[model samples]
Target: MTSYNAQEHHLTSTTCLPKPGVLIIVVEDDTDTAHLYQTILATRYHHVAVCHSGSEAVARLVSHQGPAVVVLDYHLPDMTGIEVMATCRDLEHPVACMMVSADRLNDQEAGCGEAIRLTKPLGCQTLLQWTAKLVHKVQTAVHGEGPGDHAPENLLIGQSAAMQHLRTLIPRLAQSRSPLWLHGESGTGKELAARSVHYCSPRSSGPFVAVNCAAFPEALIESMLFGHVKGAFSGATRDHKGFFEAADQGTLFLDEVGDMPLPFQAKLLRALQTGTITPVGSTRDVRVDCRVITACHRDLAQSVREGAFREDLYYRLNVLSLALPPLRERQGDALMLADHLLESLAREERIAVCPLDEEARNWIQQHDWPGNVRELENRLRRALLLCDGKAITVNNLMLNDDERLTSAPPPSQAPSGVGIHFSPGRMTLRQIEDAAIEATLEACDGCIERAARQLGVAASTLHRRRRRQAA
Candidate 1:
């Protein structure tokens, strides 16, 4: 381990591109392979360090001296690369990671979908190019320059005041060791904000473990958060290290925090307070050093008031909070983000960068993006794929002129006789309601819940109204 850092280090790329003391850690199990990675990184980036096992790599990460790019091997002597990443969740300064596997593993299988994995039998030039790019991005970010300037398509890309304010707050939150709660509409990039905080903080070298709280089954959440000893349950064949333990010295991003089961909130609160988690079927409590970052689309404060959430837990989690502005509020940002997304999509698909038509750009600007960046990406991706050539027209996005209305007006300001429009548009309120309900239901593919959401009413209300209309 000591010999790893004894080698002479460079601070610039082979092309003389200034990299200024960037540290690139290559974690590999084999001696020859580790040396190969070291040689490749030394050619392109400055200060390369090699580690043989997972534990040694983690130890190197914890002692990180500056901005870094970690090229991790999937299999190791003690723990898997994913496990090591999990352990580094709370690193103070954000580090970029590239997982390498000899066993034909992809990024998803490596449990780090955000970064793609390189297959075994590494390409020296390919590895150097990727790591150099990532290192440059990380260094640029650490120096307090606006990241949006470099990649406007990044999830955090936005020049709007709301986004700028968020950029300022990220470091503040990262500097403090406080549990953070993020509230935003779906697709507004809550997890992005969490990652921003993690990378800006001192714990940026640790794993950044993200879990969709709502994605897990109610019965399994407890075991998932607190590791379960083997035989704790019928299917518990081996001991499991839950989210809390995995996130030690890092950050555990609990997305959809509002959706966590009611019964588990007490246990969660206890762990947050005590900084200790007692695994299932274990008498011992292990101390966990990690920051808890929670996010949800719903109004958690409202949930607390409605008694759906524990007040104590709500207050605890809410000690720090950030409200992400929806895409609609970030003026002109949607178009900018769309352009960036399109460029990337074009590159990935091996096609020319598709230009947006006047109508398409207008649609993007005028329309309210209720689903935020996620929606923007999907729409653009669809347009990119469906486009014939040269330009993506409004039709490419499937945005008919009628759907261009920014938002439905308040009930009081709604147009009269929107339904059926029988006898040249003179209709009773009931008739109009019936027509609107019918149209919305059809648009939602007869999904009552979805129709109700569109209609700004409860699903049951939509159901009752639908029944009455049928009668």
Candidate 2:
């Protein structure tokens, strides 16, 4: 059994009425069936009203002044379910209307609202569950929780404008079958966004296979992507299915797609355009029905312009693009994600849930999460391992700001590797500090205290500077 906490109680209490009257207008001509619904709802709600016709139900709804949920039969003698819903729209009266019908409606035509079509001989449990969810949604909406407050499964946690905009667009994008391109910085959860789209889509039950374009060798790229027949190469032993074959009738995620060689990109474009792929050293071309979702940290358009990536292939993959905002841009979400990760780690480790103190929270929030969610998770994991009591302190979280700053080579060590060169002609103060810190760390082999002494700064100040670098 799942345990319900205070938050869960708060979630459920929105629909819990204290003998509050819920006016139910059942528009069913069948007297026996209407009575059964009336009986079920009346047992819990304070009031229940019955109407035999659509016109009568509309009139009652217009006259009613309090909360109401409507249950309309599809095969009404006068109006159809869609017609009743259209009437509600015309009246400007928002009611939680559910359609009871024996016929199936097209899933795509199902509009937003509490309009659910329950077939005849409905199971009590199923009806109750749907009703409860609908009622809760209505109550939550009425109480100013906002539509976005309801957490849809697969939505990554973040309240930043970038994330909010992405969340709003996800459902719209999921309705289409076009290829989706996810562009983001490295370790920025590109795969998570791809998975979110796949799960939110209609083909959620289908498989989700991922392949890293940069991980595979150039020699095996073709065989790995389009499969290969036995004896195709010297090492070939048996026939093997490739990513496309494995992801048939599902989603195929291509990570670091910009790294894919030009030759492979041409083949990939052909396969995508024709919905057919020929195995390596094989004459047979197999048809595949799979959604292609690709991601890359590099600027693919720039790559195309530079002749490193194919322009036609870029156009093919960029049909539906979603640029994932880096963690540094997603403010407040860092703390939210950190809390969630801490709780999750506690549960997984069977340890007492530890709260991140003010100092720790400040450090986490202020830090520039270059690695994004992945880096945050790693820091939290390390903190959890080092924590002593039910609290994660700044010290417990081994966030090495100096090491983070020095990870990237200085501008002086760029392609030229002779002297520092800034694209805009001058290096900013922060960049200078980062370069200096990198040089110092390199000289001292990551000895922060020694570096601090050499730089004539306090060790604590050096540490704070490193944290600021991370930010």
Candidate 3:
């Protein structure tokens, strides 16, 4: 395998000055694809190199002088992408890797490494975005600008009295070995609180493995968390280390733990109580020394009372608890967070920060943010993408008439009509309109005439749209 250097081969255009002090290595057996990646990266970086095989990549990375980012293809001729990244651990220097593959790999297939995974047929914009993100992360961590003494305050991102108390409680809570329960509404940054606790604790040097309990299916929860030995089940081709094993000597954050299935709760509690987990199909138990942090938006106590959750697991996790305040409860912090998020979003997107206009500011302050910080962030990001003006206004945020009419909080008392429910930014404009029309029709008991009347559209127009949707 041969390697081409950007500086020696004049791969970069003379007009563009590459960013300093970073090297990018692209590993792809396909010559055309390798050159394409090298050319694209050379636009923003000075040191760009290409290697055709995994063996060549491993050789170059092991002896690389400074910080480097590797763009690796999954199916290499000599070895796989995960095998190549596994070698980086033995390197004397720092390295960040991005694994690109046409086939989506499962958690077991991806391995426990921190390499960012990207599916094939990748867009140019996505490639640049992830590369820039990885570069920033590696640089910050290497330069000591990462988690430090002020990690809690820097990470949690609020200064309200409630926020202050939460930050103060985090360090103290981190000193213990108890399981932490973070209670809050959706988008209140429960996972952020858990991270703050992990960074402040003695296990800061170790891994912080976070898994959403609700994201796992009932059949997979046990194996996904406690691990599995090869031949344990169908598709279990090789031994796999789960979240518990991966988080050894660190923090294991279980977000939305209230959604964990009742059957699996007993297993989780046993692991927590005994500090030993038995992988599926294995007779032996492996001991773990990680702290567990659990968070839920809903009330676990209520779930227990309703028989949806276990009382024993509830008591086991609630030993040390923290209540995260919703954004609406934190006075005068919305504007501050808006400014912070706006700047952060701009920097990540590599765009100029769009200042919030007066009307937008007023709406932000007055409107009750039911979705909390997540909503604000989504709105700001959407506004940045949609805004073409000098400043971000309420209209740019799509908050004025559109959201207030269709997506606003429901009235205090229902009028025996259907309440349309959907998450913002998750649906396209066409989808949202379709949902609104369907809900209005449902509320009108399938009377298209009344639905069209309420939807402010002519009956003929509604019929035409419906016909188009069906076809």
Evaluated with TM-score, which candidate comes out highest?
A: 3
Better of 1 and 3 by lDDT: 3
The candidate that wins on lDDT is 3
Q: Candidate 2: TM-score?
A: 0.54
Q: How do all the candidates rank in terms of TM-score, highest first?
A: 3, 1, 2
| Tens digits of per-residue lDDT for model 1, 314-397 | 989988999899887786687888888998778655688889998677667665566789888877877898787669976677
Off by over 4 Å in 1: 1-155, 399-471
lDDT of 3 by residue, 372-440 (tens): 998999889889877874799777776467454543324432223357777788988888888888887
Evaluated at residue 442, the lDDT of candidate 3 is 77
Ranking 1 against 2 by lDDT, winner: 1
**Which residue pairs in model 2 clash with each other?**
368-470, 368-471
Evaluate all candidate structures by whole-model CA lDDT and list the values in order: 0.73, 0.69, 0.76
Tell me the deviation in Å of residue 390 in model 2. 4.5
> What residue runs in model 2 are displaced by over 4 Å at the alpha carbon?
1-155, 348-351, 401-471
> What C-alpha RMSD separates each model from the true structure?
10.3, 19.8, 12.8
Off by over 4 Å in 3: 1-145, 399-401, 404-471
Better of 1 and 2 by TM-score: 1
- The residue-by-residue lDDT of candidate 2 on 50-150, one tens digit each, is 87755456545544533457788876665556655654532212367778776665543334322776777755444556666555544433554333422
